[model samples]
Target: MQYSDKYLAFMGRAPKKIPHWEHWSNPDAETYLTGIDYYEHPRLCRLKLSQLYPQLELPIPEKDDPKPRPKLDLKGQSSNVDEHGGHHVRWGDTETTQWDWGKHFKDAEDVFAFSPLAQGDFTDIPVVESRDYSDEEKLYQEYRKMYPKEWGDKAPKGSTASVSFYNTMFMWPLLTFGWELFLETCLDPRFERIMTEFAEINRRVFRVFSRLPVNFVICHDDIVTSRGPTCSPKWMHKYIFPCYEEFWSIVKAAGKEVIFMSDGNMDAYVNDIMACGARGIISEPYTDYKKIARRYKDCFLAGEGDNRILYRSNPDEIRAMVESMVETSRITGGYMMCIGNHIPWNIPPKAVKYYLDISAELAHR
Candidate 1:
């Protein structure tokens, strides 16, 4: 099946089969893959593949150096792909070394500054809205190169857009201030100011999403923990949704579909996201898939198989997990089976194969 065919199904358009996608393992996952990769460096070919396809081993030249994997360091900075299609790393938080003296308010900028963003004042951002659009431009170009069918060239497969940018509301605060500081900031009198300025900052930076040629964008916000919303839902409505509301407004005007992704048990916020006009919802295991599929069948639903199962499950347990996800996901025509959150290297290869095998068998069933 052509890659685009499944994408067509995802968009509720006509297609050949169910849609599927996979991302490269993170740099750190290498620790678990050392045995398979053999060498210090691993190639893209060593990344996960569909069990449906025959394995064609590519010879690795001794001198060729594989591209480096991304990193998320302390202070909440990450060279993660969700930000810029892997072009740049995100920088937030600043004070990893401060003693007890740093907790109290020093000034407005301190409130804004961080383990990264604390020193940043809202007004300090230039009104000119300075940023390079080259990353988005590069993505557009890459899409044309890889999926020329979308651009109306002679087509190998017919599918819709899949790539997207990762943006968040509450996570940024968590990244900017440490968890404790961020939670406390929600109670500070200046909380609204900080949120507004950050939202404005996002407004300027995210203009690229609207201008891109594609009609789809992915957004991410890890707003909830395993238990429930980390902060009051009211705070999220007041401080967070406004920013997403504005961001979604731009995409809406551009005539695009947004697939929203998050980690945690955020069932309460599903309606909130739907209100933002998210046409698709990608979630971790914490969110109830069966419940959501029963409610939002019109919207595309992807990602539900928990990574923890892969990290620590026997073959029987893995089978049960896939069986349950398939049962729930198949209810909605838009479901795409994927490992929710992540698949760390520590996941047993046999278990990974088991997951993939089931996905291959039941993807379109």
Candidate 2:
């Protein structure tokens, strides 16, 4: 099968074999070629290829030099005196520093500053309300001009394009508002209204993109905790699912596949995800693949290798995990093998190579 054919099969076009590729371990441009070569290798001629091009660039932060620890004063006060002589009240309810909420916005004009939108800082700003519709349309047009294949590329021969919106809803609320306040807002009627409004705006942005010829719409929203979801199933059902249903339905209606990426164990929400009309869920290997495959046969599954094991496990252990994942979940189709999450930066490069080489060998079987 060609790469497109294998990808389509994974997306439920036909009963076919899963594609095999090297794991992304090296933080270098070579990873892309390695993936392409893995699919093109003679042993895996039966599978198809799907090339993913990640275009986002981030500034690397400067590292700090290690230093000795400073001694503590231990008296809940500073030993070194300043111009104020460190004589200020040490303990008093009235002496506490007051928070100025006004500092959040620099000024009244800052309300419409909209500088972050130009820089791609979609956080905190209302994407729908803040955006100039004409400018957004121009941006979309430019993207389409640059990568016509992403939208115009047809199946059976060419690769499809997928773009991801940062996991704004989940990230913003937790980072901007305190966690306690965010949770409280979920229960509050007024806050729920705000969430709904934001969700609608997000849905509109997606709708505009869906009108283009893209093959897939991917959204990243981390919904799970170490144990389960941060919000209860009932709460998600009440506040979150409806927005997803609307969004997923719009994508499906537009004839584009929808995939969601989340982290952590998500064994409990597989049904809820299917109900939202998402074609697949990507996450770490913590999710119970066998259970999810048995329940939602049509829904695609991605990422099953345990991320932590990549840093510590030997080649044999990695091979075993890959073999078991393929044997158990790829039987009925709709499975893609990937690291449970992005390969860690500190992992030895050799271990990463071993994981990919082993995965290729297993998939050939």
Candidate 3:
């Protein structure tokens, strides 16, 4: 049986031709590449893109897809101006709708009084589930329904079964109370109980994950800004890292590897995250990929490629960027070609094509 490049890369085998796990979103670039209007022919545009860049995993819609609706009824209040009827168009599409940010809480006192376990339905929160995970078996059954019938409890050989949690330890408070309230109350002694409650909620979450048919779990938490850590090392060690160790240990014991994902520079906490039992990290371009490569030795790593280099539309810079990424891949077998900052709507189409072209030519061991 031939193993997939993704599975091989995840397992650190270093396939001859390195694979791509890009975070792409530039519909205008897609239209420019395929000459198909993305709004009119979304599926065809993606299919053509996938054909042009065979390494990319672009999803093809079954039919003409409509604009995505907000998951929660925010009742018209949103931190994003776009969600409040403000049109911010770039590259032929309006800004995507955003979820309500801290609309539930009136103040720090309200945030302090909130109990995550008591308010079990997180449907209103961005990127989390609506169901109550109070019962582990019930949560497991619900989560198990997400996988295919042929798989049972084990993932098919050469194929990966995976689940991603958006509100990992740091995000629970961030999403629940928004940035201001969380920061205001995080230093207070009262915040300890709040974090403990959030941990209990995640204990249910990770316990459910342990029993699922997944080979890996992508735990996402933007613990750091583009500069560095949002909270100090001391604070992170106190609340976040400990929970990461505890929750990840659950899935790790059940044979599932953890891939920790965060936005911004992870230079400060890469070692800490690794120590917490993550098999790898896939973070943004601000992170030092070479540092992680040198230290970890074939552990999975990506987000070295930067979209700023692509956006500049300079062929030499793009080529150099791809070359640097390939050099990192040489050091670590699990490296993937990814433009970590994202290829958003406004990035130049020609530049994206040039980046892809260079990557195809040189992203090989």
Candidate 4:
């Protein structure tokens, strides 16, 4: 099988052109690009856009009819209703977010009393949102089912058949205890036991990942915010980074490369993450891409492009952004063109056009 340029880029092979790895959700951009009404013909619109820009890897919908949207009570709300009786101003695919640690436990004391190993099964837990996560073998089988039947138990060489986990390490406690509770108790000596229990859980997780039929594993944990680290470096080294080293080591032993994904500024921890055996990082726009590219020398970095630039709708700025990305690509074989913050549903279509067209014209090694 012919490996895609994206797969090559993921492996740090430096394909002739810089690959596009985007977080896209701009329905208006699709309509503008394809000349199709997205709400009326969602599938055909995506199909045409995919044909137009295959590098974007837009998913081809299996159905022509748009999925049913929720009829929210928009009384006294600013959102306009569409002909389909749905909210017209969509910010993203859905209002629902993953890792919603709803009001399960009452307080920090309840969190401290919890034991991940004793629970063993996490389906009952509000934080373990992923299915089949309680059992390592079952989780492996579940991921195995996602790959093509032709590949059997192993992905083809150079294929991008990979798995991603949202709560890599830091998120385990954060999701389990809820944000405020986690912060309140993280520094206490008792928190070490909680972190230890969380680490044990991830040991099973990474071992399962090692057994999967994939070449890469994308591990996501928002260890930092757009500003900087949420937990200090000293605290992180004690609790978080060690688990990453141990868990990632499990997959690395099986010849699988780890791709560390995070949101916000990862500038401080990039080296630490790399030291933990990640092939590269895909983070938000707050990171220093050129500095990473120059230092790491093409270890698969992305999320340098900013959506704010696109939102501004300035042609020169968009072109300059694309050109700067291309310059970074010249420095590193593993650079991908990505708006780390994302191309949300509200961004102007014309700005999206300029970014893509300019990238096509100039984003080459």
lDDT of 4 at 273: 96
The digit string of per-residue lDDT tens for model 1 on 1-365 reads: 54454465466443334555443343343323334342334443344321223221223344535543324454355433444343444322111222222334444466655322343332332212222333445534544554444555332233355445443566555555556666666777667777765675566445656655555667888787777787777888888877787887887686667778887787888888888778868877788877877887646776687777887758778888878866765577767767776665446566666677666676555
Which should have the higher lDDT, number 1 or number 3?
Answer: 3
Which is the winner by lDDT between candidate 1 and candidate 4? 4
User: Sorted by lDDT, highest first, which candidate order results?
Assistant: 3, 4, 1, 2
Candidate RMSDs in Å, in order, are: 8.7, 11.7, 4.2, 3.7
Q: Per-residue alpha-carbon lDDT of model 3 for 167-204, expressed as tens digits?
A: 88999888778888889999999999999998998999
Clashes of each: 13, 5, 0, 0
Worst 10 residues of 3 by lDDT: 70-79
**Candidate 2 global Cα RMSD:** 11.7
Worst 10 residues of 4 by lDDT: 69-78
Residue-wise lDDT of candidate 2 within 1-365, one digit each (tens)? 45553465448553344553223423322233334232124222112212222211122223323222212213444234438444333211112232222235443233233223243434344432233333556556654564656436332233456656654355434433445555645565555545654565566567666666666777777788657889888877876777778877876787778887778888888787778888877777788877777777656777777757777858777778888777755544667667776564345556766666666556532
lDDT of 4 by residue, 65-116 (tens): 8754323312433256567565454355444333347368788789889887
CA lDDT, candidate 1, residue 234? 81
RMSD from true fold, candidate 1: 8.7
Clashing pairs in 3: none
TM-score of each: 0.69, 0.67, 0.91, 0.91
Model 3 scores a C-alpha lDDT of 0.84
